[model samples]
Every structure is written in C-alpha cells, then in structure tokens.
Target: MAYWLMKSEPYEYSWSQLVADGRNVWTGVRNYQAANNLRAMQVGDRAFFYHSNEGREIVGVMEIAKTAYPDPTDETARFVAVEVTPLMAAVTPVTLAAVKADPRLVDFSLVRQSRLSVAPVRDGEWAMLCEMAGISA
Candidate 1:
C-alpha cells in the first residue's frame, strides 16, 4: 500500500480530536498538488497525522477509511477529500527537527516540500519514520 503524510493544524484538528471523533473527512485542501495527493489515496492506505503549524510533529497514524470524493466543504467542487480514522498514536512524537536531522530522510517530501499539506511518503522513508516514532512499520 502507498503511504502518505497529511498535515493538520492543532487548533483546527488535533490528533487527540481525531481520536475522540473516531473518524472524519480530511478536507480544505485548496492546493492542486495536495488535492491530487488526496485523489491518489486508496481505502486502507495509511497516513502519518502530522500536526503542523503548532506542534510540527507526527503525533499519530491514521488509515484512509474512504477514498477520494467531492469535498462538501468546497463551493466550486474543484477539490476532493478522503475519510481517515485513527490507527494509533506514536509512542514518541517525531518532530520536524528530528526528521530534518535524520540523514535517511533527506529526500522525504516533508523535507523537500515543507509547505505541502499532503505529500507522498516513500516506502523506505515510511519505515524509517515508523522506527523513529517507536512504532512498528
């Protein structure tokens, strides 16, 4: 399965909130590239729940419960969204600093395209990140 990293602002939608909600539509992606990434997602694919802006860390894991669909939050219908559910919280939150320092993750999309809200994660990078987060890949 393909892997991904999806960012969410803590104030807007925190990892704790996702756990509490159980599952929710991942929406509000206005960037074409990010929307395309969302469209690429498939049901059962796993994503790292990166808490951007505030925490700047990957706090948990989530599974794509539903594939891409028309985003109800969008007025023009140009964007799409997927449904994600909490899989498990990281035992050790992986910070941006930690990620940047890791030589193995030098080419990771999260490092290369820092502003991208949704980004693809390579298989090797995914495994390394899971290791850093103290979780099984």
Candidate 2:
C-alpha cells in the first residue's frame, strides 16, 4: 500500500483528538500540492499522523478509510479530502529534529518540502521512519 504523511496543528486537531473521534475527515487544504496528495490517497493506505507547528513530530499511524472526495467544507469545491481512522500510536514519537539529523532522510520529502501538509512517503523512508517511531514497518 502507498504511504503518506498528514500534518495537523496540535491545537486544532491533535493525535489525541483523532483517537477520541475514532475517524476524521481530512479537509481544509488550500495548497494545490497538498490537495493533490490527498486526492492520490486510497482506502487502506497507511499514513503517519504528524503533529505540526507545535510538536513537529509524528505520533501515530492512521488508515485511510475513504478515498478522495470533494471537501464539503470548501465552498470553492476545488479541494478534496479523505476519511482517516486511527490505527495505533507510535511507541515513540519521531521528532522533526531527529528526522533532520538522520542522513538517510536528508532527501525525504518532509525535509525538502517542510511546508507541505500532505506529502508522499517513499518505501525506504517509510520503513526507516516506522522503525524510528517504534512501529512495525
């Protein structure tokens, strides 16, 4: 399955919130690139739940429960969103500082496109990150 990373500000929607809600509609993306990434996602795909802005760390795993669809919250109707369900929390959070310090992830999209809210994760990078986060790859 494809892998991806989805970021949410902890104050707005933390990992705890996702866990509490059980499922979430991932919407409100304004960036064309991030929007496209959401559109590319499919049901069953795994994603890293990242707490951006504040913690800047990946704290959990999630599964895409629904494929891309028009975001109802978007009046312009140009963007898309997916439904996600919490999978499991990372045994250990993978901090942004740690990612930056890892030579293997130097070329990772998270490093290259720090502004992206939704980004694709390569196979090798996903495996390494899962390892770092203490999750099964």
Candidate 3:
C-alpha cells in the first residue's frame, strides 16, 4: 500500500484528537499537488500523522479507511478528502530536527516541500522513520 505523511497543526487537530475521535475525514486541502496526493490514496494505505508548526514531529500512524471522495468541507468541490483511522502512536515522536539531520532523508518530500501539508513517503523512508520512532514499519 502507498504511504503518506499528513500534517496538521497541533492546535488545530492533534494526534491525541484523532485517537479520541476514532477517525476523521482528512480535508481542507486547497493546494493542487496535495489534492493530487489525496486522490492517489486508497483504503488500507498508511500515513504518518505529523504535527506541524508547534510540534513539528510525527506523533502517530493512521490508515486510510476510505478512498478519495468529494470533501464535504470544500465549498468549491475542487478538493478531495480521505477517511482515516488512528493506527498507533509513536513510541517516540520523530521530530523534524531528527529528520533533517539524517543525510539519507535529504530527498524526503517533507524536507524538500516543507510547505506541503500532504506528501508522499517512499517505502524505505517509511521504514526508516518507523524504526526511528521505535515502531514497526
């Protein structure tokens, strides 16, 4: 399955919120490229639930529960949203600092496209990050 990194500001919606809610619709993506990333996702695919802005760390894992669908929150209907369910919390959150310091992750989309809220994650990168977070890939 495809892997992805989905970012949300801690104040807006944190990993703890997802765990409490059980699941949520990942929406409000207005960027074309990020929309495309959402469109490319499928049920069962995994994603890193990253806390951007304040925390700047991957706090947990989530899995797509539904494929792309017209986002209910998008009035323009130009974007799509995927249903996601919390999978597991990181034993140790992988901070952006750690990610940046790792030379092997130089090409990681999260580093290259810092402004992108949703980004693709290569299989190897996913495994490495999971390992660093003390979780199974």
Q: Which pairs in model 2 have colliding backbones?
A: none
Error of 1 at 90 (Å): 0.4
lDDT (Cα, 0-100) at 1 in candidate 1: 92
TM-score of each: 0.99, 0.98, 0.98
Q: What stretches of model 1 exceed 4 Å from their correct place?
A: none
Counting clashing residue pairs in each candidate, in order, gives 0, 0, 0
lDDT for each residue of candidate 3 in 61-137, tens digit (9 for 90 to 100): 99999999999999998899999999999999999999999999999999999999999999999999999999999
lDDT computed for candidate 3: 0.96
Report, for every candidate in turn, its global Cα lDDT versus the true structure: 0.96, 0.96, 0.96
Give the 10-residue window scoring lowest on summed lDDT in candidate 3: 23-32
Cα lDDT tens digits for candidate 2, 77-137 = 9999899999999999999999999999999989999999999999999999999999998
Measured with C-alpha atoms, the lDDT of residue 35 in candidate 2 is: 95
| Clashing residue pairs, backbone N/CA/C < 3 A, model 1 | none
Distance from true location, Cα of 8 in model 1, Å: 0.2
